[model samples]
Target: MTTTAEPPRSPDPGPVERETVPRPSQDEDPADTFEQRKGTRWLEPRLLLQTAKQVAISGVLGQYNDKRELMGGISPGGYLDLGGAGTRDDDGNLWLDYVSDLGDSFEATYSVAALLSRPTLDLAPQEGEATTTRRGRLLVMGGDECYPAASVDEYENRLIGPYRAALPGKEPDAPFLQAVPGNHDWYDGLTAFMRTFCQRRWIGGWRTRQARSYFATRLSDRWWLWGIDIQFDTYLDEAQLAYFTEIARELQPGDAILLCTAKPSWVAATDEDCEAYATLDFLERTVIRPRGAGVRLALTGDRHHYSRYEAADLAQRITAGGGGAYLSATHHLPTSIQVPPPTSRARSKSPSVRYTQGAVYPTPEDSRRLRWGILRLPFTTPAFAGLLGGIYAVLAVALGAALREPARGLPADLRAVDAALRDAGWARLAGGLADSILALLLGLVVVGGAIAFTQDMGRWRGRTVGLLHGLAHLALAVSVIRLAVTLTAEVLAVPAPWSLALVVLLVFVGGGILAAELVAWYLLLADRARLNVNELFAGQAIPDRRNFLRLRLEPDETLTVFPVGLPRVPRGWERRPDWRAGERERFQPADGQLHPFLIEPPIRIPRTPPATGAATSRTDEAHRMDEAQRMDEAHRMDEALPGGMA
Candidate 1:
């Protein structure tokens, strides 16, 4: 029997320690390789094609509705029940539960639930060796709980079902769940989110405890958690503001407050002058700061990563949106925001809280690692453009020779280049060959100039890029058609109608080329301000890792937060029996999680060092009590920004 031979393998270059390699030039396409010209931009033509289709659909249907005015209809007295009517568990046995970017991707939800169920070991601040497992009393979901849209069906499969499956032990006494609506939730007019979280509908054993999407819970006499619903950037209605005004009246001086909203005001407010938004500023003025609540902390979940910032006022901001969704980049945080260091070991005084700066992930901070991210872009834009360029070049040569016009630099007798086109029997168009070629070249220049001009234009940047991108594709198609028509009549030497039919096919191909490029542009460049899917889907270089924040309230009423960072999820995690498939069933678990929960070491909160022997004084207790009283009177503060619940 003859055996099939395996392909020959190249000899390994083996360890060359201390080797120096030059980085690719700035202008060079990162996807370029000797084996491929124009790079791997067309590597995932499907994604390009899909994006094109979506763009077309969006243009025709206007997929989004702006409800800014409508959502601003909140009533000042519209406060929701924190724990349903009158069930009071005011023993400070509270769990300030937090998760964001949830309600989508079943596998991711499953993994996140498993991760949350995984017990965490917390070390006592006073004891070097003592540790305990701590859990939250309430389950607070940040925002974007459902994927694609906020329809009830989407939530049933993508959000509630997977969570129930993952945390099967949840019972009537399970931590209460409260959420703020996100953009996706508002897509269906907040119908599903309202039903799931605000209608007190039972999801597993957890029921929604809010009358409206936004809420205020009395964590304790000295602590409270407030969740606001800024429905897709709409204003916080007067009712919501009025409810918080009442909350301010009940506040004690020494009490600490936690603010939870739908999106990260600090990160999302890139165009704003300050780190937070005008809405957040308004809220701080009207509600939070006015109460004199000590140690104000703002929690947001729109950005799918973990980031923490501290302003000079000691107010803390955090993004813990990585509850269960596609990961976002930490490097994309605006340069203006001040990130706090991970540990405060050297400081003499310990603040009431500490936060991790930048992103704390398991990935290495190496040059090669970052270079891979930059290279991902070429595959999306340049690669698609290259494929179109390649096709046009081939067609140009064929039609150019049929008309006897040599490509500008080539010799006149360069018949061997496209000798096959000579037999197309299009002698009549031979005289016009040179003219067609020149026109094609002119179109290229015009298209290039238009792109350059738009790039430099300051106003309407996104619209300009989109228009120019479309124009460039159209110019390419026009040039190709001009060349193809010359030969179309002769090739289909039947009736005039037959030749017309063949020409129409060529036009269809041109449309496909246009569609492909349109999709590529959106996938690669449309939302450059935030981390996008190109790096993971097209480049396939980075791992599918996620980061989250875990907050556990201490017995002494101090909040200790641990930034839990998960490693790159294994690709094979989808094979588990619990996995589901199809669009009718949700596509085969790619772009999501389906494995057992696993994570690197949890980032622990820094502790205050023990002090030398000292006795407590009644003055200290009296001072703390006085501070609590002062909190009740400090009401006229910063204006409050209308924020949201999921």
Candidate 2:
């Protein structure tokens, strides 16, 4: 095993350690803290509108305001030295953890944080396995620390609060923390992300070190990790490039790199011609390749699930975004992909690398079944249903008014409109809709909005499905109005004022629920076609199957990855009895149902020889031998398991 001396620490001592636990001020009761225990309801009307606005504003600002450029003045060179945390174990192995897309609702977020805060985890190996893994000395938060939008309050409540409560006290040899920014982090131009992470503050017991959003750190003598920030799927800024370029100068011919980014561009590139992958290709070819250093692995967390892809000779691409956000579907994942996609501008004469999909968390079948949960949207997101109801009510009222005779005094006009709706049949309603210009315009808006909402599928297909979805709602609203009018005025024989109130109530409640149900079904069918699949799951806001990666850099230079998954996160928690004793955290799972199992057998990537100063090509015979060895190892692991890995 190769050993390296520990890097020296800064002469200046950092901030004083204090009680980091999130508690109500001295005056408040402790029991009131966990009142809001669920994760972000993505379908909530207010949140949806706020998120849309932030996305729009951030998109515009990203074009003109490059936050990385401003960061250059604050931290001239964007690099951090975390090697002092002592990654090497007694046996000369290095351990590290990678988590991302966390900080949503309290239940899910804290459930994950509590487990990560443990000193070590003794995972019982399946059918044929050997050892237990210890906690990582180096913890890397991939991206999107908080969801919905990046703000001080959101981070404090969703992220820092739970994390602090999980590991409140600062220990002598605490893990060092570093992070990369995702799109959500950029919503506030990275103001909140910077303040929370780059300021070298303590998130629970983990110590922050990076001064810039992007960072490069050496893990061991032969291993390095780079967390790059590509803001909103945009190009990497010049300063970020320069920082890594400088770091590359210190690299030797054979050093291995583990590249981390906010989004999984390789996956995105497989579907469309986008600049995200182009920029990553530029970074690898221009910077790392020139130094003879190869990227052995690529990691990301925007998809909120665990998936691994491997090519014959290229680095493994893994998307493990199951930190603490809503679950995303894995059924639609392509069986294979080509990196530096054919349409990418960065494509070279060399053929694109073919990567085969490997293990995926929640299994594709389970992910498909999970989509059905969206059917409960009406109940889970009442506000969204209310918004739909409000729109239906407005359209019904407009059409009712248009059907009445020429304007009379207010009272007379109301009576005439009510009577017209009461006596109107389906045929009469349809005829009236043609002449109701106000109602016609509102219907058009509904259709247009629905069409715009449909994404991923091609224009024609999306428009067709979106149009059908809108028409279904329009028909439902008309039927609901007619039924409500009949029930109030004819069947019940209610008075004018009471009848009007009952009709409005029926339209809002009945129309809202039916309209929302239409949306749920549309999303479900669209997902079956692999269109708008993200929305299908996001609308559900599932807080289960959360996961993270624990990696061990072995003595022989091989890297083994343990993809840990929490099938169902615990919602209830209680204060730990030993919390005051300083031996345990502030809280533990109340149900004691926090069992984290492996997503699959550990994936081990064998060590490769360092790249030569000049590019070299492998002979057909050599390539065949390498493939055979990998297959033999995989076959052995498969035989050890009860059911073979897919």
Candidate 3:
């Protein structure tokens, strides 16, 4: 029998060795974090149509879906009830459940699990020498573990059932699984989140060991991981503040802290000041910074995309929320953040990262599945306005003609309509009412247009777009006036008062529709420029990728991070080396609801203290080949799956 040579394992140092963990270099420049990429444009026609739908839904549901009160209520407690300690085995490393948006899609969850099963370390491949399957020691869910209101059924179908199917184990796989509640989980008063993640119940093959929403896990004696619950607001409550305050006292000097947040506050910054992510600032001042904790990294997952940003302090912020949710566009980000300049900062030289990924935009297929545009505002506004305008215009013109010559002005077919109005006593009120209505509509158009124009002045690009819309409105107004005076008097002989009313109403509605279109388009443009400033400043569009990170404390205390992307594993890696065709059947779903596993493109991580000359060369050639094989394997998997599984 032939045997393949295996890679040697690194020697394990004792847990007490403190010198092995290196402090972040002060001379490391933040500007050289990631390679600069061009910004993705937000003005695509499909995206514009999608964004209009989002705005309409938001208007009705309000950002948190009218469940803000339930989300805002605090769940008060500390970590003492669950022993407040992380898992410790004799392997000289820690394996964690590092994922976010972990519910809803069965296919995506299974793919990520399969990818994670391939690696034993940040860069090393796990050879199937001992067992066909691999498992982590601990699980750390980033957030949003459930979806669409956190109901019991959502937990069962979206979270528990899919994950159970993905991992495929009956016994306990990990010692503990910790999580923070996300906005969607809070929509149903956190009842399901608490039952599944915070209690002692068994979810799939994973056990819940957290007593509260927040936790502090000791990866080693010197390395720690802290996850804070942000609730619905930007501020932490008193109980949470007190709990962390007490825990900070025990942290040893030189201890590297990995902060896990429910939201990516740094990237969510609306302006240079970063006002939207104020909770992070609050945590920095009150907990991490004041106590002198070495906060090396922060991980988050709310935006449903992957992004990385680094500050002058050597602290890295990552968003890995792409587990199984609709993707968010990077181009719509705010303009304050700048990333990937291709060089280190000249002044601070502190290490920083700036990178983002392209998102899945709404397409023709999505439009067919959901008629979002037709159902929402901005799109529907025009049709509604036109209908109202047509009805009012006809009424006003008919009234004007009937009253003009009172005796013979009525056409034979419309005489009954005039008689009906007269019998109802509305005829007497028509002339004065028509004049008043015309004057009112004319005034509304003038004032509304002026207000909208003034608001766009500060934003030059917005002002330019609005100008086109304004011109359209102007044409409509002119047409309305001319139609009433010339067409009505010369052809229909309608009275001046009622004719003018018809003109005013049509002009007002048409102009308003034009103005609304301008506002919707302008907001989309501004959002794209502002929110994704990182990629724009970098000069390239970020790739479309979903990722989760695994941080392990080596025996020497040096921390290593394995940033894993979904479906990026080698094709045959998931199949047990000893498995026959019959053994593989045991892993398949009983209900025959199997989906062809997808593969992810490998992410290249730069070496520490990145070399300016040989950057992007650090990823080993062998590892690259392993990643390259995933494409062919993906096709094979696709062919293997049953027709209905896809």
Best by lDDT: 2
Higher-TM-score candidate of 2 and 3 = 2
lDDT (0-100) at residue 269 of candidate 3? 55
Tell me the TM-score of each prediction against the true structure: 0.59, 0.88, 0.51
| Candidate 1 regions with alpha-carbon error over 4 angstroms | 1-95, 118-135, 169-172, 271-276, 312-314, 335-357, 360-468, 475-543, 570-646
Worst 10 residues of 1 by lDDT: 1-10
lDDT string for model 1 (1-646, tens) is 0011111111331221221222122332211211111112224446456544644543343235433233445332233223221232344333445778865454456556555544343433221333343444467788988765566777877777655544433233444567888776776566677678755555443445565677776654466688887865656766666656665665554466778988775555453333335566567544654455543577888766666765433445777776666555554454444222213232321222222243333322431244345333434355544555544444444344445534454442354333333333333323333355663564455455445423223446644674566465545554555545555645644343344444445644554455454444544454353223323333332334555556655456555565555554534223334433210111134555433221322332211111224221112433355544544346333233223311
lDDT on C-alpha atoms for all candidate structures: 0.49, 0.77, 0.46
User: What is the TM-score of candidate 1?
Assistant: 0.59
lDDT-superior candidate, 1 or 2: 2
Candidate 2 residues 464-533, lDDT tens each?
9889888888888888998899889889999875676688889999999998999999998887777888
What is the lDDT for 498 in model 1?
42
Instruction: Please list the residue runs of candidate 3 whose C-alpha ends up more than 4 Å from where it truly belongs after superposition.
Output: 1-91, 113-135, 172-175, 270-273, 311-313, 331-544, 567-646
Q: What does candidate 3's lDDT look like per residue over 358-440, in tens digits?
A: 22222224312332222233343454345335533554444444443344443543443333232222334233233445534
Full candidate order by TM-score, most accurate first: 2, 1, 3
**Can you list the residue pairs that collide in candidate 2?**
39-105
What's model 2's overall lDDT?
A: 0.77
TM-score of 3: 0.51
> Stretches of candidate 2 above 4 Å error?
1-37, 76-85, 125-130, 347-350, 456-458, 581-583, 609-646
